[model samples]
Target: MGVRSLPAEAYYGIQTLRALENFPISGLRPLAAYVDACVLIKKAAAMVNGDLGCIPADLSQAIVQAADEILNGALRDQFVVDVYQAGAGTSHHMNVNEVLANRALELLGDQKGNYQRLNPNDHVNYGQSTNDVIPTAIRIGGLLALERTLFPALADAIATLDRNAEGFQAVVRSGRTHLQDAVPVRLGDTFRAWAQILSEHLIRIETASGDLTLLGLGGSAAGTGLNTHPHYRQRVVARLAEFIDQPLRPAPHLMAAMQSMAPFVAVSGALRNLAQDCVKISHDLRLLDSGPKTGLKEIQLPPVQPGSSIMPGKYNPVMAEMTSMVCFQVMGYDSAIALAAQAGQLELNVMMPLIAYNLIHSIELLGNTLAALNHRCLQGIQADRERCLAYAEGSLALVTALNPHIGYLNAAAIAKESLETGKSLRQLVLERGLMSAEDLAQVLDLDTMSQLPGDT
Candidate 1:
């Protein structure tokens, strides 16, 4: 207030203005999840403080109403602090406080930036500190994202994969070891395997997110719950839980919640694992859809975009490629999270800003990427049945089925002869009178070799 003349209409006061001037690092501003979470947390803190008689009821009502407007997407653009700003997200916390404070003052028929009427720290952020408020907001942001976006998207992916697995059960294809044909396997096995892996990953992500339910709302400047009532932490968390409809509990050791960025690391690590799986699945899809003429061409990926600038009728596995890129970004975000998680000195982690931004970004990107991939690429996939069977029937590993009937040496000799004479395995075996046609047919069913071929 002593520094310079005020903007008569500046909703965010001196602190937020200072942050905007200090950190111009990222052109990007804090996103909706974060801003919304901040507003929601402020509202909850005001309600709890009012309940404890720590703040006047009229002021509490004004703060809650102003914050609700922000939560409903009003004045969000006023939160203009860069995501890469001061550590522990103090800048963002102050940004939210100042905006809500000024807005509440206006609501109470006072001019904006009139701190005497409604101070940011003393009124809106009454019983909170940056340490507790920032981390609590981050948790709320992540929980809302996972519950509202990521989980439902993954469910759709799982359903699509399962349906495809059943549809492709009869498409037998050559399985390779070291890029060489090793055996025949049902094409559906690949889908089923991905479905199972993704399902497990979803469970792991959810389990990891469960840790966020424990928040550090009243842990004040440090983890000591300083300047707050004994019942403050419990009541604030209860208010948050009722408002968000989440099973939230006050963090047992406030120090642990404030100091350790371990929870964000754990959730980010879970996301990294899921991203790794997505990359693998996407790569597999790319390989299967490699070529229509010169490559494997065992399956066809949906041709959403033209593959090349020069080549005509060329369609690339762009969605799968996109999935891989998004997954890799998630991995990179995980590395940043891991580094930020370790930056805690003693009482509180100073890297909360990085952790919060990356964690929220990764969840939204991964979920949206998978959802689009399932709908645009995976669901429209088709198997090249004739190509799959041809590869399976012609594969050198078809000899493995004959290995039991014929000695290894004999099988080797037959394989060599077939290669030299340009003969099929069946033709070479039958020409040598090694087995009758009926017997060979029974033994060399490619579908059965693929996986005990139940029906086919």
Candidate 2:
């Protein structure tokens, strides 16, 4: 937007330089993944435009070659625009356009900054606008990261929990509701519940991301398709689907797609749900692995590091604690995304820079944290069978087994006496001759106590 001394070797041009000077917020550049996504779109567009006779085959081939080099991560450091730059990711979009245009000029034997031969606006960004392309790139980048990172990490965590569920089946423990023991349950039951939560989170992610299959490509400035060939949308989308290996389609109403951030909001909501599930599972693991001597000590977590420098033998559930913190951060990102999604004024959302940064960052953070949690903690967790059974035997709520036969009042009386007398619920029931020994044996069987009421 202003006169400037261009860097002698920098591939980025005046627009990217202006962005760097203006928006220094966050000190973080747009992610390499986002840049690669943008380049992939340019590559596909160039191939399609050349085939449609809209652009010269030689120039289109050069553009595609530049995009390929960027896609394979040849010049990642050239994308210097800050992620917190101008809204709708204009700076970020122009940053990619300039980089690709200059690179294409190099491949064509033209010196850098020779815009007359390969203009960033006229040739490289032929049929696209920042309004449509930026958001589309965000979605594509997110989908790639989800498949290659987050989803795999999630599956690892779930499989770890699944294995522990069956492995700990015989470790009967006191079940707590509201932090008070209420009945007996197998350790497997707790893990199974956590697995179920993650499974549901996965389903929600699938359902929410299904909306992203429809894209706003070909929706040029204000979605009017100005200066673009009518068939460009269909051909480009078909090319993109084949390249992305995902079945994607153009949105029916280009203008509506360009203006709405609803799909992004839905995706962020799914991430939030997954984060909440992580928070709950992590908190439970932290509580269960609290203290080897003084706290619950019902389960032992593999010690990854020294938890405290001042205390001896102080091993903490660091993985689970870290997971909890990561989840909290993801939840915060979800809230920011929700606000940004709502901040969409008529044709564009100015908060998209934040949206793009937060969503990809949240996904990457969650993926890494989950993999660490699974490998460092869940995989090596050992059930404290003796401690679990000890607590099960000591629980006063074991009188719950007698409720079916002795009635609630009588059972409550036995429960109260067992607490006051420092005796087991079985001992109190036997002392009062409430039932025959044979009947009591069957009612208080450890395996039977761990079963659900329906099973009993």
Candidate 3:
């Protein structure tokens, strides 16, 4: 590795180059949000250090300018380390440092890789270590993702579902539990339930994210605050809060914060919980939109693509299918994040690179998938009123309402006779003298039975 040279135009230096060789695993680069988080940290550190006179004003200005340039969408490709590189994300952290240092060197009217002018570790990464910076980056990355992607996406999806629920409120359909008809339910209530589920998930995600605001940025190599200015922790956190417009604060216990990855695990767990519900909702959509000719096509999902390669004129629940796949992937990432979170040793968790990638990726993937599903499928769903009414009227479980008018045993006998004789429940009940036609009609009213509690 001695005397090796990088390309003259390359902003990343020898360390990133060595990482390129050492860990040729997964060709993936650090995520955009992850890079922005690291750069924001670098920018804040430069500002604080310059203010405190820990680094020269001109040098700090150069570093700040370099970070700003990256923030403003420059040198996006300079972070070249593989995502699966060095433990604790040291490789990627150095990648950020080297890229900013070389760019800062260029800003100072010097050539790249001229560390004699300004070193990546000594200047750009002053008072910061991979242990602290990577953790802080994970936190910042998570917050950024939540604010910019997941929260807004969830809000829009929930609003859409609420609207759909209100629209379908009058359409009564058969409710199924354990794949068997249970009772009557308004189709709108089905959507309203989904909306409520998403709303609760949003709350849980926000709760879990509260822990992300507590950062260990000043911990340096081991949460000891070694080599940091006396006021560096508070100043840096304040600077970062202003930079991201978040209420980021120093961890009350920097050692515990740096040593544990519980915050990330919590957020990922919330995401997994949301994914579980999403899978159920997606499956429900598929079942309701199952077939136009044979299956229970109570509702139709807007087809985004042709369902099959060979089946002509066929439509599939592709968006809902895609959502289920993404949610399953999120659940998988949550498990990985949980394991990675618990894998830390006495001082640090070296599985941070994996945690960072999986957690951030899961957030973005889920947000995007849900957004797409809402727009392409959920919002476009159309209920077949006739089909829903037919199912509601035909279900043998509708006899549940007859239990109060006739005895439970008598009602069960009527339902069993109707199923066996191909006669309607109303027909069997009237023939058996279970109740008068007028009382039976009122009892079996779909609208009355499906009305939500408190509904007029």
> Of the candidates shown, which would achieve the greatest lDDT relative to the real structure?
3
lDDT of 2: 0.87
Ranking by TM-score: 3, 2, 1
Candidate 3 lDDT (Cα, 0 to 1): 0.93
Q: Tell me the lDDT of model 3 at 387.
A: 95
**For model 3, how does the per-residue alpha-carbon lDDT over 115-164 read when each residue is reduced to its tens digit?**
98899998999999999999999999999998888999999999999999
TM-score for model 1? 0.96
**lDDT (Cα, 0-100) at 262 in candidate 3:** 93
- Best-first order by lDDT: 3, 1, 2
TM-score of 2: 0.98
Residue 225 in model 3: lDDT: 94
Find the number of clashing residue pairs for candidate 2.
0
Query: Who wins the TM-score comparison?
Result: 3
Write out the backbone clash pairs for model 1. none
Per-model lDDT: 0.89, 0.87, 0.93
lDDT of candidate model 1 versus the reference: 0.89
Per-residue lDDT tens digits for candidate 1, residues 1-456, read 458554765788889888888899978888688787888889988988888899889889999999888887788778889999998898988999999998998899988878887889898878789998988988999998887778999999999999999999899999988889888988988898899999999999999999999998898998888888788889888888988899999989988898888889999999999999999999999998988899999999999989899999999999999999999999999999999888889898889999889999999999899889988998999999999999998888888889888778878898888888889889989988989999999889876788844545
